[model samples]
Target chain A: MLGGQFLETAIWGLPIVIYPFLSGLMAGAFVIDSLAHLFGFKQFEPVAKLAATSSFAMVLIAALAPLVDSLQPAKAPLELYFRDHFPYSPLSVFIIIWTLYVILMFFEMYFDYRVENIEKSKLSGIRGSIARFLTFGNNNISKESLLKDRKALFIISAIGVPLAFAFHGYIGFVFGAIKARALWTSSVMMLMFITSAIVSGAALVTLLYVIGYSYYSKKNVVNIETLNALGIFMIFAIAFDLFLDFIDKLYSFRAYTEADVFHGWTLVYNAGGVLFFNYFVVQILLGLIIPLILLIFKPVRTSKLMMVIISIFVQVGVFAMRFNTVIGGQLLPKISQGTIIPEFPWLGFDGILSSIGLICLSIVIFFILGWLFGWEDSNKNGFENQTNSVDN
Target chain B: MSYRSDFSLKEADEDCNQELLSANFMSWLVKSIALGLGGLFALSILNSSDSADATEKNNSNLPTGPINNHRWMGWENPVLDDKDGWNDWDKLLNPKNLPVWYDNFHEIGKTKPKHHWVMVIDTRKCVGCQACVIACKSENNVPLGVFRTVVQVMETGSMESSPNGMVVTDDGNYEPNVKKFMLPRLCNHCDEPPCVEACPVKATFKRQDGIVLVDYEKCIGCGTCIEACPYNMRFFNPVTKTADKCTLCVHRIDAGLEPACVTSCVGRARIFGDLNDPKSEVSRLISQYPTARLKMSQGTEPQVFYIDLNGNLEGNTSMDKVFMEYTYTIGFNTTAYKKLGGEVDLPKIEEHKNPFKEFEK
Candidate 1:
């Protein structure tokens, strides 16, 4: 029951929110890909190819979210080519970082699939023709060439670990650098973003691995050991993310000036009813805390059904986290106190449809890559088997 | 019979030749006419620029005053008719006709007089009529639901008595006893503008004279500059598709005219001039009055200063009843203001309430 008051918030809408979330997922998936190749984690080896292909698919679709969200979609290229003169802007740096990461990941995927593509090229029809074109006429499938491909992938994955961190960490810096918004301006924002990205990435790849394994092998080849390891990794990442959230709350209570106290309260307590629930209940309880507790149990970690359910919850929770961070930060008026702007429209170009469209588009890309790479035919003699045999 | 047939055939052939020649002649004539017309059209187009210049010259020569019935009506100069016509006519009729402020402007670039432009607003004189806001909107062509300037109204302290002697709240639930004051707000044109720093393309930059401007072409409509501004002064202009804010009326200021908001202010509350010049009105007022800039703790060094500022200017009011009034739709809400009703309850004041009084002992 407030009196005549107007609330002004950020002009950015759902597309901008989805852009960061999708990019975070992409970065997270790539980090998981690096876990097997670069870190030589045996538990992740079985899913490494799956993770790499998923990450590549994610990267291919990452730019669409922001480009579609831009008011002038045609002029978006100017962000890199024409107007990227300012070195101080996090966004300018982001363009360069995102481009480099995409190239590295793309090349890594290409080399990983090169031998298989040459084999597929020897067959007849359009798929073979496409495979032949993809092979770029490098028909030499000698052990030495295959070894070189592995070495190249190892090198790229090594560089990609930091690149993944930078790609997603810079997105956090974009929001954190805004000194105007009280909720967004914090040094811990980048760490929070990166940690949660890992949590979400682990959850998504685990879910994809289970689905792909069941579909391709026609058996419940859900690797219990891999799922257990991923469950553990997710727990740690979620713990760190929650710890940052705790520290942010504590800092608000202790150090905020009198003028900023209301903003701090809005983030924790007085955020409108829906947003409050979204932040506290959905993000913290369901997304972080519940999953953490569930993953701690050996039975839940080993159980395929249980792990899949927890991963789904963790992803939902991560999405809620992003939603709250982005949309919640913009609810309160910058100058006025005790008033909140209503949520943005859920329909239209900037709303629910566009977000759903982007996700659907990403799925389409994932399936297309799956078909092209013969993901379903896991029995096929390919790099994954070769790499597994070498590791053994 | 054979000779007669040959003669008739020759005659028929001659008739056919005549018809073909006439047809060819007609087509040639049509082509020649079309070619001549196209050439004339091209020639006219090429000479149009010269004609345009001549027309501009003709416009300048036209009488400055309205035409009268007599041919020589506007030809006579009023200054020339005076006694000192010989000495003053040339000066008075000069096309430049510079305003008095131009002398001060010319002096600025010549010696580099440490020019730091500043604005001083006397809150005591503001009546909340919003002339300044309207003037700025028209001057800048600000779109609806966005403002280059705004007037913030903060009401506090109940009045002792109603001026009309009949006190009634709109809802008739309580007495109308609110003491309200309007605070005019615009871009402070801070020395360290966060918006300028946040621009990825350097589209928005602060000029040497302290006015910040946006290069619309380079902006790319990122809206990051709008996000970085603490005061919420910058907004996306749908017309230009770029972030825009108050330029301090730089166009007018360059020609030695006061900002439109300053000129249009009904209360004469706003004063604008170079802060470096001690003789400037803004400088004198700053020295004479106790003034404060908004959000000084942020260290932006805002150029817009306020005098007699009161009632939670820093937005640190502890009163539970005070709520901000925004007269336009913001975010997703289309309602003009959130539920406006009931008399504003004023906080009670304690007599002899100074916390520092005990410390003095």
Candidate 2:
């Protein structure tokens, strides 16, 4: 088995396979919160709020991702957070950490909301009592309480930073342990997951902010400075990702491990090959590189619209990388001692039912949660007021 | 009595406090000492077991010996040796270090056989007889659609011939000659095996005798090992969920007899032996004739050598077709197949039209 690489096993099926993605998203959210609140980067204040909202959405999705594998989604909790399963895998460890993080994030969000509602609400009796219990009976909007809450937020955000990275980085480690498949056997896969996480997180923030500011207000509060800074960050992240990709590909080529390079070459040059150069150039260069270059330029980067569009490309580019990495590694054949050839389904094999449906459900849940928590609305309301005041 | 009755509430509270304080201290001290001893005892047991278990597993079953010696040790029994000093190879071989080439073995008499057992499969000599196949099936009780040895017939030239029984060529009717040959395929039982490496659970392990075997109960049914065998010899037995391949009749071989397939071959094409023994039949044949192995470039170093191997090194063999069928599940992607030298060209079928679309319009 080509030096016994186990990377392919980590990505064999869908629901179990989505562990890396869920863990990565959570890690990215925590990183953002850490940057804004814990590290005290005032310019990164928007990211703190954004991270919390995304964290909440991602935690909710992760809580349900396991249910996709179970016959009964509701009953999954009994086997997971409640009772012990026979064998403990890396996935089991991830589930435990993810559950703890989700609970903590939920409570933190609840506490924040309760404070806000304590100021807004005039309800009495049980509703009031429940609200008081959540806020610890303090409805005071005093400077001291706000400062204390911020400190607590900072402490949790700091703790969350590494927990987030561990969530996804471990998935790569799992794949690397598989020595059977040559394509998935390298240490570089872990780094690839991490870099991709950064790109996705940055793009997500850029998209959300641009949409919130543009639709809600006649004037955009997000100036050229903020948008340009984000674009520069994204460009560099994408560049680093490409650099890592080059290293990984070159290493595989040099090692001749499991015929990965040979198989990759044939797919590139063969007449009837499914993987065309056009698809490669579009997905890798035009979608990822060109946008990165455009973002690097101050003139283009300064435009909020340009930044948002590039962010979308960055996100798409990262997904293309993931697809190629997962699908490309598996398409080679193993011959005991002869030349091997590989063939793949032209349309690409459809992901398992749970994997696709769970991912879709996660997206829906994210948007719905975003709506409920006023994540988009707060920015929208803030932007509109600023613009109206400027006009007056 | 009058003085005792006159005791104030403060005095009574003090008496109760003194009694309760002594009991609380005693309970706390006793519990603390008991917990400390229990923790220390548990820690020692855990520490000892962890180290001891690890040592026991690692002390054996690791690659630390010459393959033949390891095989010998696996089969040896000190108590049952004869006066002549013939070791207990009979007891040792079966369920021990019997090579993958072993299919079965049995004893005929008490007299020691003059020659150590060996078989040689001349690909040039094989005539695709189904007799050997049937014999092997009955002898080994092999499962349906599964065989210990399969005959792969490859035709090098076109079927059509010129008049007077001459092979036709596009250039001169002489360049491309019609050539057909039969290669009876079985596990090579490689010295360095890819299948063993591919098994995550160590279910498919290599014996010291250079035979690879699958522990069916231990196998996770991942089918990864099946994909790793370049010869495409191993197959997943759906019944057991473990990778199954030819075991060269280890039972028969251990009993000082030939494998079922080798014994049954009508053409006398199969051979089995220990290459290590200088006087063995396999060694004699190797010295006497030029020998080759199927797909030697796979780096497995197969123990089963062929006399005068006729097939092309890069030719499309029957094994390639089987490999293509199970590629997806095993993570043996399309890329690896092309790289290992398989024909990229296949007959392209035109896309079918959607009748529903036409009907709807």
The best candidate in terms of TM-score: 1
For each candidate, give its TM-score against the true structure. Answer: 0.77, 0.55
Flag regions of model 1 displaced more than 4 Å. Answer: A1-7, A216-220, A254-258, A267-274, A373-388, B1-114, B157-179, B315-322, B326-361
Q: What share of the true interface contacts does candidate 2 keep?
A: 0.05
Question: Quick one: RMSD of model 1?
Answer: 18.0
Least accurate 10 contiguous residues by lDDT in model 1 chain A? A1-10
Kindly provide the TM-score of model 2 when superposed on the true structure, using C-alpha atoms. Answer: 0.55
Chain A TM-score of each model, in the order shown? 0.91, 0.76
Task: Give the Å shift of residue A350 in candidate 2.
Answer: 5.1
Task: Show where candidate 2 strays beyond 4 Å.
Answer: A1-26, A52-159, A212-226, A252-260, A268-273, A302-304, A336-355, A368-392, B1-361
Which clashing pairs does model 1 show? Answer: none
